[model samples]
Target: MATCAAPSESDAPGHPDRSRDDRWAASGAQLRALVDAFRSEPVTPARTLQFEHDVQIVVRELGRQVVPFRYNQVEPAAAVDQPRHARFEHETYTRVHAKTRQNVWTVFGQLVVRRIGDRPSQAGEPMLFPRAHRLGLVHGASPALAARACQLLAAAGANQQQILARLRADHGVGWGVKKWRPVSRAVSDEMGVYRHDAQVDQLRTWLAAAGASTGRHKPVVCVGRDGITLRLRMKRGSLYEVASTSTVRVYDRRGTRLGTVYLAYAPEPGRPAMRGALTAVIRDVLTRWEGPVPRWCDVTDTGDNETGYDDRVLRRMTHPRTGAALAWVRVVDYYHASERVWALANMLFGDNARAVGWAKTMLTWLLLPGGVNRVLHSAAAFRAARTLTRVQKKEYDRAYAYLRNRMSHIDYATYRRVGVPLGSGGTEAACKTVFIQRLKLRGMRWAKDGAQTILNLRVVFLSGIWDVVYGRVLAARPQPIMGGHVAAEPNELEIAA
Candidate 1:
C-alpha cells in the first residue's frame, strides 16, 4: 500500500541532527537491509501453522520498519514565508507555531510529525493542522490506516470490540475506542463523497456487458429493496430504528447474475437520500444503454417500504433521453408469498399433522402456473369441509385476502417459465450482510453516526468498488493550509486488499 507522494529527504526520528543527505542515504541502506531480511524469510509457511504465524509477525515487522523510511519522505505541506494574517470567511487567524509535533496513526503504528499550525488570536480558539488534512489524515489516522480500519469494520460477524481486537491481532496495530471512533467516522464520511458516482459507474459497466452478452433470454436486471429494525444506542426513549437496503443486479442471458450494486441507508424519513441515489443510477443506465435494454424486474415482499420504492421510484420510470416509460416486471417474492399461504394453512389446521401436509401442497402449488389462485381455492374448500371457530374464520379471511389481492404478483410459474427471478434473494442477502449480520449482533446498539460509519463501508465493499472509490477519496484531500493561500496537492494513496 504505497502512497503516491514524491520522495523527499527528512531527518529521521532520534537523528534530527543528521543532514538531509545523510538521512536519505541511511534510509536507503536500512530499506535495503529490510528487503534482504524479507527475502531470507520463507514465502509459504502454511505447512506448519506455527511457522505461518511466525512468518506473519516477521512480515509485519518488516512493514513496520519500512513505514518511517517512506512516511518521513512524504513532502511536508507547510506554508512558506513568515506572513502571518489569515482570513477565513470573516475572522482572521495568526501563525501560532512555526512547527508543532503531533502523533499520526498508521498500519505500522504511530509516527510523530512536525507540522506548521494556525489559530485565531482570541483565547479558546482551536489551532488547525493543515498538513494532516492535506495528506488525507482521518483525524489522526493516515489514509492507508483509515482505509484498512474501515474494511476491517465490515467483517460480517465482528462487533466493535472484536473489530479492534482483530486489528491488533491480524495487523499488529493498536486501536482503542476513543481514538478509533472519530477516525472511522471521518473515513465513512469521506467515502460518502464518492459513493453515488462510483456505484453508478459500476452499474453502467455491468449493464453494458449484460446487454452485449449473447444468451437464450434477455439479460435479467433485478431491482430489490428491503428493510430491517435495528436496535439503537439507548437514546431519548427510542430503542429501535428502521434501516433499508436496496440493490440493482445484472445477469447474462443464461440467467447467470453477473454482479450486483448495493445501497443502504441507516434511517431517514422516507429515505429520500437513498431513493435519489438509486434513481440516479438506474435512470442513467436505462437512458444511455447503447442497444436493447435488459429485462428489468423488481423482486421484493409486499412490505410498505419495499413496495413503496417500486411504486414511486422503480415502477414507471421515464427515460430522460427517450420519453418512453421504462418497464419493470414487479414480482412478489415467492418465498414471502409462500409464508402467507402457510399462515392460512396454520389457521385452517391448527397444531395438526394435516397442517404440514396442506402447507407443503400449497408451497409446491405456488411454483405451478396460476398456483396462487389454486392456493386460494384449496384453502376455501378446506374451510368449507370443516366447521371453524370464530377466530379461525377471521384469521382465514385475513390471510386469504392477502394472497388474493397480490394475485398478479405471485405468478411464479409464469416467472419460472420465462426465467425471471422468483425470490428477492439479493435483497434478503443484502439485509443480512449490510444490516443484520453486523448491526443486529447481540446486545449492540448504535447511534446514527456510529451506524453510518459501518453501513457506508459495507455498502462500498458489497458493491465491489472499494479500491476504485476509496482512491478517489484519498486523492480529493482539502486544499491549502489555514494561513497559506496556496499549497501543493497531496499525492493519491491507493488501498488494496
Candidate 2:
C-alpha cells in the first residue's frame, strides 16, 4: 500500500554526470579539439582513390555476394487505379449465458463513427442494438460461474453480511461460502431460493402495521378447540395409544368463512382413548362456545372401545349455575351417526359423562321416511303410520306424539337459518387447520418448545396478525437482528446500525 509522501529535494554525491547541460558544456571544448585534430589528419596516398581501380578490377574477377532480398517495389505504375472492394472488419463471441448478452452492430458502428468524428457531426444513425447478424456471448451453467454471477448480483443488490445471513438461516436459498485453495470463497446462489432478510423484514413490517390497525377492534367471539392424541412405538418397546389434544379457534370475518387449516391437528370423530382426555376436550368446547346459547351443555363418550369408564365428563349449566353428575354408561358401539341420538344424549345428560348408556336407545330406533329415523316410542309419527309393520314399528303410536311435542317447542327447522352452535366441530376444525398445518411435517420430530413455537405462530396466523406478531416475537429474539424500537412497517427505512 502506498503511503503519504513528504516533500524533499534530490541529493547525489560524487556523480559522474550532474546534469545533461553540465556534461554537454564540459565536453564541448574537447569535441571541438577532437574535430579539429581529426580534420588535420593525413590524407594518405595508400588510402587515396588510386587504390579503388585495382579493387574494382579484382571485384569483377570475384562474384559479389548479393543478399536474396525479396520486397515488392512500390511503383506508381502510371496511376492505373482500379476499383477495390470496401474493407470490412468484424469479430464474433460464443457464450453460454446468452440471456444476459446482446448483439449491437449499430453500437459498434456508432462507436467507430464517434471515435472518428470528434469534430461535432450529427448526421449519423442513433446508436442501438441492431438486428444485424453477429457472434453471440454464451454462458453455461457451470456451478462456479453461476456462483460468481450470483456474487456480482448480490454485491450490486445487497451487502456481504446480508448474503451470509441468508446462506446460514435460509437453507432454501441458493448461496453460501466455501473454501477455495487456502482462502474462503463466497458462492452466491449455491443453495436454492432462501429467504432474504429483506423479505422477512418486509413480511414482519406488514404484519406489524396490520396489527396496529386492528388492535383497537373488539375481540370477535371465537370458538376454539384443543385435543390430544397419542402415538405408540412398537419397535422400540411397544407402548399404548396416548390421547393428544389439539385446540382450534373459529371466528367469522367479513363474508368469507374458513373451515380448517390444511394438515393440522384435529379431533377425529371416533378415536378411542382414556375418558379423561375426552372430558378435557368437552370442557374446552363448553368454555369456548359462542353462538346459540344453550340452556344446558352435555358431554358424552363417542369412541369405538370402552377400556375405561366415561364418568370423567363434566358439564356446566348457565341459568342456575349448578354442577351435575359426570355421567358414565356402557355401550355396544359408542360411535353412532344419529344426530337425534346425540341431541337426546346431550339433553338428558346435560354435559354429564354418563350418557353412554343411550347407545341402546340408538339400536332400537325405527327408520322413518325421508331419510330421517325417529324412536318408535319417542316419535309418534312412526307409530301413526299404519302401513308400517307391527313388529317393525312396535312403539309407532307414541313416536309421532313425541316428535310433535319436541318439534313444537324446539322449532328445530328454524335453527338452520340462524347461526347457532351445533357441535364443537368448528373449534375442532380450527385445531386441524391452524396447529397441525404448521407443526406436523412428515418426518419432523419436534421438541415441546419447537412445536409450541409453531403452534404459537399458527395462533398468530389465525389471530389475524401473524405477520405483525411474528415480527414482534422475532424482534425480541436475539438470534435475529433485535431492537426495542417499535416494529416498523414494510416501507419504513432500515434502523441505523
List candidate 2 stretches off by more than 4 Å.
1-418, 434-450, 474-497
Candidate 1, lDDT over the whole model: 0.74
Residue 72 lDDT, candidate 2, scale 0-100: 6
For candidate 1, the 10 contiguous residues with the lowest summed lDDT are 1-10
Model 2 Cα shift for residue 388 (angstroms): 18
Question: What RMSD, rounded to one decimal, does every model reach?
Answer: 6.1, 33.6
Tens-place lDDT digits, model 1, residues 1-497:
21222222233544333443454566566666656665777755543565455455544444554554444434343334324655444556676546666676667565666666768767787765556656667777878888888998866888878888777776656678988888888778888879878887887787778777777778888888888888777647557778888899888777778899888888888888788877887877766666776678999889887788888777668767777787789999988887788889888888688999999999998898889888889998888887878888888888898889999988888787666889999989998888988888887888877888888888998899999999898777655433356444333321110
Q: Return the lDDT, model 1, position 244.
A: 82
lDDT of 2 by residue, 95-123 (tens): 11111122111100100100010111133
